[model samples]
Target: MDRPVSKVREAKLELYRKKGNIHAKEVTGRFNTLRWGMVWLTQTIFYGLCWINWESAGSVRQAVLFDIAHEKLYLFGLVLWPQDALLLALVLIIAATALFLVTALAGRLFCGFACPQTVYTSIFTWIEARIEGDHLARLRLDAGPMSLRKLLIKTAKHSLWAIVAIWTAVTFVGYFTPIRELLPTVVALKTGPWEAFWLIFYAAFTYVQAGLAREAVCQHMCPYSRFQGVMFDPATSNVAYDRQRGEPRSNRRQAGQTGDCIDCGICVQVCPTGIDIRDGLQYQCINCGLCIDACDQVMEKIGAPLGLIRFASETALVAPEKHRPWYTRPRIGAYAALLLIFCGMGVWTLEHRSLLLVDVLRDRGALLRETAEGEIENAYTLKLMNLSEVPRDFIVRVAGMPGARIVGEERFTAEPGSIRPVSVTVAAPSDSSLSGIQPMLFSIQAADDRSIEVVEKSSFILP
Candidate 1:
């Protein structure tokens, strides 16, 4: 039996539909300038931060290194340990909230302007344009027969892309492993297995995502575009086509027979995701405003007023007079309020965070031991973390039982930015009236600055 003709045709079309690649036309205007400005700003911060030097705890190192080996994070003057993970959690919360607020205020602003994918793709495409001429030239070259010149150009483009990708990977991994140390190892071709693995992995990912995947990553792979509707409202500003003025689009400029769009298709030509804006907003649109830039240029050339396509809200396009200010909208205001609250909480928590942390573990081997002097003994291990920048001596003390006291060394010096585990014996008079499990408090205080303190509670076994 044979399959139906419709089914076979549909299958063939589906297979061939995605055969070609998109070569977005080069556009220059206000939005293009703004996009490049963000690319410069973000890349400067990312690639330059690793090379910045700072002195911490008498050692010079990268200004913002997350020393995973030591389980510590160094950010300029602040040193954070695993125990300070709450601050990191708060930071993440503030970031997520900020993203939500921005999305409510302006749709896909991050994706269009500052997303790593967008930024890197812009860079990759810019390089491609510089080497391969404009979009039409590149498309012709791709469609034409293979030649030595075409092969050389293609190889050169990819070689440059690989260089940029590897550099990006190196900078990314530098945050986890000190760039200074990693650089020498890289030069020597002896990077650690994990470091090399991440560097190659990230490099390959950058190359593929920016060079090969391009718009597919934004349209199909990214979850942000799929659910952006949830964050959008009537007042959320987005790159939109003004249908009232652009409808009845025609190329010929006969008297009263034309719309502002001119039917040129430049907007579709320049779109990174290849969506026609005049058809209305679609999930494939990144809100990049390249179409706006392209349309503005075309309108300027034809002596027509600009803004045939622009950033507008659904309310503004449907009923301009009924549209309200963005910040005035209740949903936007609510998002802003929540964002501010999360930021405030993060700042407040960081401001009041403690410099010392302590954990006490009671020995499970023996509940209680009889001492030679007729005293009840209990063993414990103390894990102390010093989060400050300077070394300090910490004094340990035990309390709660009538005659409870620490028998071992009471004072110990801890190195700056280090965790120390100490074993201590707590002795109480065996003849004391206390029996069963007795509640006890273990306190550690800075010898020099007594105001710095940490207290932990544990049970003292009694026999």
Candidate 2:
């Protein structure tokens, strides 16, 4: 019974929704203005961040790059090795927590204002509007027979879209491959197969997802929309219609008494997702506030109060809900606490991170060899990682067994942020009683700074 009822409702929705074409009518209001502002800010950051270069030890590279080839992530002065994956995990958790907190207070704020799909869709639509004229004009053009003028107009519009999509792809890939280096490789047609593939794939993805998919992505593809309900409470604010204030809807020509709404369909016409705000909240709604802007214009023209459509909570609209401080809310407090804890841990870990790291790899070729002085010698390769921004001299020493000492060069110089491998041979007086592997320790200390040090355990051979 439930399935049948839902299918019937879906059929009704399909009838009401526009077929193929959805050119949202242009609107102007505070929300529209804010949306445009966010579009500019986000696009600027995305396109320009890869070009920022930082210099270290007379070499320059992208400030924020994840050099997968080199197994290092650079964010300005901080370089994270693969072992620092914990910090990256913390960052993801913090971002998710922050999103939850925002959702609990103002629903889908990020999705509407800052999501990549929404941003790119707005950009593409703006371009379409510019090239093809207003929403009405585009509709007319689409409906009319194809002509040379229509062909030329469409060609120009698509060319512009292609340019934007390709460039967006380039900028996105630039974070992994330095933009300066990648541009040359691209121009020379020397990009590797993988890079070329990503370039084409990403370009097509952006073009189709932003220009063609549009609201369909939000309505269907976005898993977040389905799960966002869990993040919402009755007190959660979202773009909604004040049905109590303006309902019993009527046209101007009708009646002795009427509500503020003039039955103007402008809100529906201007909605990107084509869902009427007055129909109540739906998962399809992006909460972009364009409907609010359109309804506000209608109210303004009719000399009615603004905000017939606004960011409002269900509880408040049903019955005036009493507001409380954010700290007083248990859910909000929990979200904040989680965010703070992760952030604190990240900061503390970064601050106290050691400048030197070491690993001891025993040579398997010859575990134990007899020395000329009646001693047993063990060969090893020391992997010393210099995580600091300056060069430092490191001294390696061996301990544990009696008369154990380094047989080869004990001091080595390591450059800033370089991993140096040193061949080390430890020799100790041979003991007839001791056999097989014996416990030993390798100490690596910076010649200038004792604080920068590491002690690693290894096994010494006895014969």
Candidate 3:
């Protein structure tokens, strides 16, 4: 049976509404140069950090490896365990708060410059431009009929994009798996299931998102672009056109034209999201300032003053007297304060965190027992997790009850980044009148390091 007409019509409408071919024309400016510089710096650190090795706990491992199988994260001199998960949470909060602060001060700064989507899209587009020529050339090529030259260009562009995407995926997964060992398996086509799965999945996603989807990810997929308006205030710095000065626009310079705008349309050509800035700030605008750069170039050539389109606050544009410095804005100040607080807490927690952690669980199967020597005994399990990088012997001692002592083992050793479960028995005189349950303290201290210790509380039951 033929497909339903309604379904086909809906599909056609959806495609037409959502799709727009954006071939952002290349422009040379300080902001564009800075964006490219960030791309180079970030990718260099990402792709290179996995291969860098550091001496860690008598063995060489990746400088920044998240060894999930061992429940350890080796970050240069610092080691993190599952117990330190709070630190990770705090770090995430700090990052998110910082993003909010930046967004409040300058609209979508992260989205425009530092976002992975923007960075990778810029790279893919750069490669595409190199292969297919500039904006006009690319448009012409797409509009023309298929030819051998077009086929060669398209094939070469996709092949290079795949190479970069696959490498990016491998480097990302290398943070979890040992890249040194995983590389050999990848080369031999014998990677484990999870490794192969993530590698292929991420590579395909990068190619599709960066090379094919492009601006659609920033426009529709990213929630930040949609909600950034909530963070925006009148004081937020954004790329805006001076409508009062530039309006009454004309394509040609009449004899008595007053407005500065010449209707050149260069700004729209250079926009990554393909939005006209003159229509005012839109959700699709990334605030990358490329339009400002394009407009400034046109103004300079026409002997007109710069800043016809530039970064300025809405309040400054409307009432210049009400304008204030970015830091003086109450919203920006609040977000900055939150970001600092989160960062400070994370640093303080990491500094004062104990190197040893202990958890005591009283044996419920046989809570209390009478010994032949007329003594009351209790069994407990102590879980000693070492959060340090070096192995050490720990001494377990029980207190808070007179004449109470550990019966069997008091000295135990824990390897680096390992959790050891120690079974212990505490015995006290049966006729001591200590009936019911009594609170006791179990202290585990490192044999060599006095600074490393943990105290846990448990109950001593007597019959």
Most accurate candidate by TM-score: 3
After best superposition, candidate 1 residue 272: deviation in angstroms?
Answer: 1.7
* Candidate 2 residue pairs that clash: none
Candidate 1 residues 1-463, lDDT tens each?
A: 1235535544533333344778888889999999999999999999999889898668787889998988889888788888788889888888887888888877898999999999999999999999998988887788889999999999999999999999999999999998988888988989999999999999999999999899899989999898889999888889999888876776655556667766767787788887778889888888889999999999899888899899999999999899999767899888888878888888898887788888898887988999889888999989888888889899999887778899979998887888899898999987556789989999899998887998898888888
lDDT of 1: 0.86
Q: Tell me, what's the RMSD of every candidate?
A: 6.0, 5.1, 6.7
lDDT of 2 by residue, 1-463 (tens): 4456546655644443666668788999988999999999999999999999999867887999988998889999899987788888888988999999998888899988999999999999999999999987887888889999999999998999999999998898899889998999988989988789999999999999999899999999999999999988888899999998786766642344667776657787788888888889899998899988899888888778899999988877887757555567788888888889989998988877788999899998987899787988889999899987779899998777678899979999998779999899998888777888889999999999998889998889786
lDDT of each: 0.86, 0.87, 0.87
As a whole number from 0 to 100, the lDDT of residue 305 in candidate 1 is 85
Q: How close to the true structure is residue 314 of candidate 1, measured as C-alpha lDDT?
A: 92
Q: Residue 113 CA error for candidate 3 (Å)?
A: 0.5
TM, every model: 0.89, 0.88, 0.92
On a 0 to 100 scale, what is the lDDT of residue 428 in model 2?
A: 86
- What is the per-residue lDDT of model 3 for residues 324-359, given as tens digits with 9 covering 90 to 100? 998777898899889889989998999999999988
Residue 368 in model 3: shift from native, Å?
Answer: 3.2
Error of 2 at 417 (Å): 5.3
Q: Which window of 10 residues has the lowest lDDT sum in candidate 2?
A: 8-17
